[model samples]
Target: MDHVPGGFALNPRFHRIAAVEVTEDDLGRAIPEHVIAQLDAHLGLLGTSTGYASGGWTAADFARMYQVVYAVLRDTGRRPGEVTSLHRDCLERVDGKPTLIYDNHKRRRHGRRLPVSESTAQLVETWQKELDALPAVPGCAQWLFPSPGQRNRPRRGHLNAAQFCNRIFRDWIDELIPDLVDEQLDENGAPLAYDRTQVVPYGFRHAYAQRHADAGTRPDVLRELMDHRSLDVTMGYYKVSLSRKQEAVRTVAALAVDRHGAARGFDDPLAYEVESVGVPYGGCTEPSNVKAGGGHCRIRFQCAGCDFYRPDPSYLPALEQQIADLRADKEAALAMEAADWVVRNLDDQIRAYSKSADEMRRKLDVLPAEERAAVESASRELRKARSAAAFVPLQALTARSPE
Candidate 1:
C-alpha cells in the first residue's frame, strides 16, 4: 500500500484487506503435506488391522475413539466440539450420499448437513456398533463418542474434546509422524528449533479446505460447503500446496479436450482476429477508444459486461465468476432497495453471459461434432509430427557455430 493519506488501500483501519488477506500458507502452523499423508497412511493400515489383543478391548476402544473422531473431522469439516458431542444416529443420507447431521455450533443451519465420504460413513457405522455394544454416556448414552467411564461412573461422562486436541494429538499423532514430531514455530512465523511439538487437531479442517482447493473447487462453492460466513474466511485456508496447483492445471487442461481432440476455440470464443487489450476483468476491443495506463471507457462497470467488447466463453471459469458476481450484485440491489433499473441491468448482463456460457458448450462451431473426430485424429497426428525431434549430425547439434 502507498504511504499516503486517505488512500484507497488494504489499510484495515479504513477498509478490509485484499481478496486474500492471510492464508494458511502464510501461517507457520500450516500442516505439512507429509502430516496429512501420514494420517491417511495410518487410516489405511487401520482398515485391515485385526491384531487387537484378545482381552484388550480397552485398547480396541481407544483405537476406535481416535480413528472415528479423526475421520469425522477429516470428512465432515465439523469442529472438535461438534464431533465429540455427535450422537450415534447422526449418520444418514443426504442427496443419496452419506451425511452427518449434527448441531452446527458455529451456525444455526444444522439442516445443512455435512456430506461424508463413503469411507468415513463406513467407519462411523463400525464405531456406532462398537459404541452401542459397550456403553453410553451417563446422561446421553447414545453419544457416538462416549467415555469408557460412562458405564462405570468414573471421571468425565464423554470424550473430552480439549483432551483430544491438547494431549492425544501430541501423544499419539506426534509419535505416529516422526518427521514432524519436533516441528514448531514462534509468533514470527519462524521455526522454534528447540520445540518438539507441532501438529494440532484443528489443522485438520484447514487441511480439508486445502484438499478441496487442490481439487479446484471454486471459492464460492467451497465457502458454501465449508459453511463459512464469508469468502474471506474460506480463502484463509484455501491456498494449497504446490503439487495441488499442478494437479489443478492438469484437470483444467483435460476439460479443454473434446471427444475428437483438443477443444477447438478452447482459448477464445470470438475465433475472429481482434487485437486484445488486456483489462483488469477481461480484454478490451476498443483500446484506441481509451486513454493510456488506466484507460477510459464509456460504460466501464465490467469489461465482460461491455457492449463494445467480446467476452470468451471458452474461458469457462471466468464466465462462471462473472455470473456469480452478477447474481451477488442483483441480490444486494434487491436487499438495499436499489432502483428496479439497477436490478434489471444486472439481470440482463447475467442472462447475456449465461448465453455466452451456452455458446461455449457448443465450442463456437469449431468443427461439427460428426466431423470433429476425424479432424481431431488428424490434428493429433499432425501435432505428433510437429513435435517429433528432427535428426541432425550430433557433432553439429552440439557444436557452437559462433562465439
Candidate 2:
C-alpha cells in the first residue's frame, strides 16, 4: 500500500513494465522442426524392447507416454491434458475411417470425433492390444494412460499432465538439447543453437496449427480441425513465416494471367511485387499507375477491362462471385427500369469477369497433373494470406490517437 500513488489507489508509483504484446511476427510457442524430430525419434523407440527404462520408467510407462505425446502431435495438436485423460475406448470407426472419439476438456466439449491418419489409428489399436497383454494392474482398466503402480498409493488415476510436463517431458527435452539446432545459420554460418524452452508439451499444439498453415490449409478448414469457434482464435495459433510467403508469391507468379486470360510470366518473380500495385482481386502493372499508388487509373478503375490487370487462379473464386453478383444486380436493374447506362455497365463487367475466369480455367486445365497440383497448392497459400490480412484496417493500425 505504501508504494501506491496516493496510498489508496490501485496504481503504483514504481516503474510499471508493460506486458509484451503478440503481433503477426510472433510465431507463438511452436517447437522448431529439428527439436520435434529429436523428440519423435526418441518416442518412436517406446513400446520396443530398447525403449528408455531408466529413472523408474518402465516399458508400460514408456508405451503410455509414447501414445500420449505421439497422438497429440499426429492428431492436429490436441491438448496434453485431453490426450492424457482419454478414456480407454477412445478409438472408434466413423464413416469407414478410423476416428478418435475424445473429449475437449478445455472447451467442455465431449465426444468430439477427429479422424486420425491410418498409421496413427493402427498405433492406437496396437497400444490397446499391448495393454491387454500386460498383467492386470488393479484400477487401471478404464484409463488409456493409467498411472503406473505405486508402492503405497492407490494407482486408480490417469497420468497427471502437470507431473509429466514438469519432470518427464522436461528431462526428455534436456537429454536432446545437445542435438537440437536451428535450421537457419547464424552470422558465423553455423547452425544456431535451438532454445529448449520452445519444445514444451503445449508447443506441440502450436506446431500442428503451423504445419497446416505452412501447407496452405484454408483458414476455415483449419479452424474446424482445431475445433475453434472463431477464425480469430484459430489464426492466433499460427503465422505464415516470411520465407513461406515469399515462396508462395514466386510460385503463384508463374500462373498469373492478363485481362485477356493469356498466361503472364515474370523473368524475375522477385521483381513482380516491386513492379506492380495491388488492386481489387488482382494487381495493376502499368508503371504510372503503380507509381501513383494505384489511384491514377485512366479507365476509371474498370480493372476487368484494364490491360495491366493481372490475376492468377487464386482470384478465381472472387471473380466468379463478382460475376454472379453483377448478374443479379443486372436483373434487379432491369426489373426497376433503371438507366440504360447503368445496365450496360453491369453487363460489361459481368462479361469481362466471366471471360477472365473462363480463360484462367482453360490455362489451368492444360497443365500437367503434377504442375496443376503444385499451382493449386501455391494459389491456396496466397489466397489464405490475403484473406487473413484483409480484415485489418490500415488506419486502425497507423492512427496516432490514444483512443
TM per model? 0.49, 0.60
Best by lDDT: 2
Worst 10 residues of 1 by lDDT: 382-391
**Pairs with backbone N, CA or C atoms under 3 Å apart (clashes), candidate 2:** none
Model 2 Cα lDDT, one tens digit per residue, 1-403: 5675553444432336743433421347777566777666677443444244433447756657554555555454787787877788988887779888777876689988877788878777887887777655567678777675455665677777875676666766676334677778999999887777777777877778877776556667777777765466666544555677688778778778888878785645577678776665677899999998777889877789988998777777778878888899999999999999999999999999889889878878999998887778677666667657544523234332232
Candidate 2 structure lDDT? 0.71
Where model 1 places Cα greater than 4 Å from the true spot, the runs are 1-28, 43-57, 107-112, 135-140, 149-156, 180-196, 237-403
Model 1 lDDT per residue over 1-403, tens place = 3575444435453355535433432334545565666566665333123333222246566666767788787776666877887876888986779988777665666645777789889889988877667644455465777653433345345577886776555555545443332246678877554233545666666667666654445566677777776555655454334454333322222223221223323243222223443343333456664334226666764544555444332244556778898999999999999999999989988887676565555653565676544433332322222112111223223332232
Report the lDDT of model 1 for residue 11: 49
Off by over 4 Å in 2: 1-27, 44-64, 176-178, 237-381, 390-403
Which candidate number has the best TM-score?
2
Alpha carbon lDDT of each predicted model: 0.56, 0.71
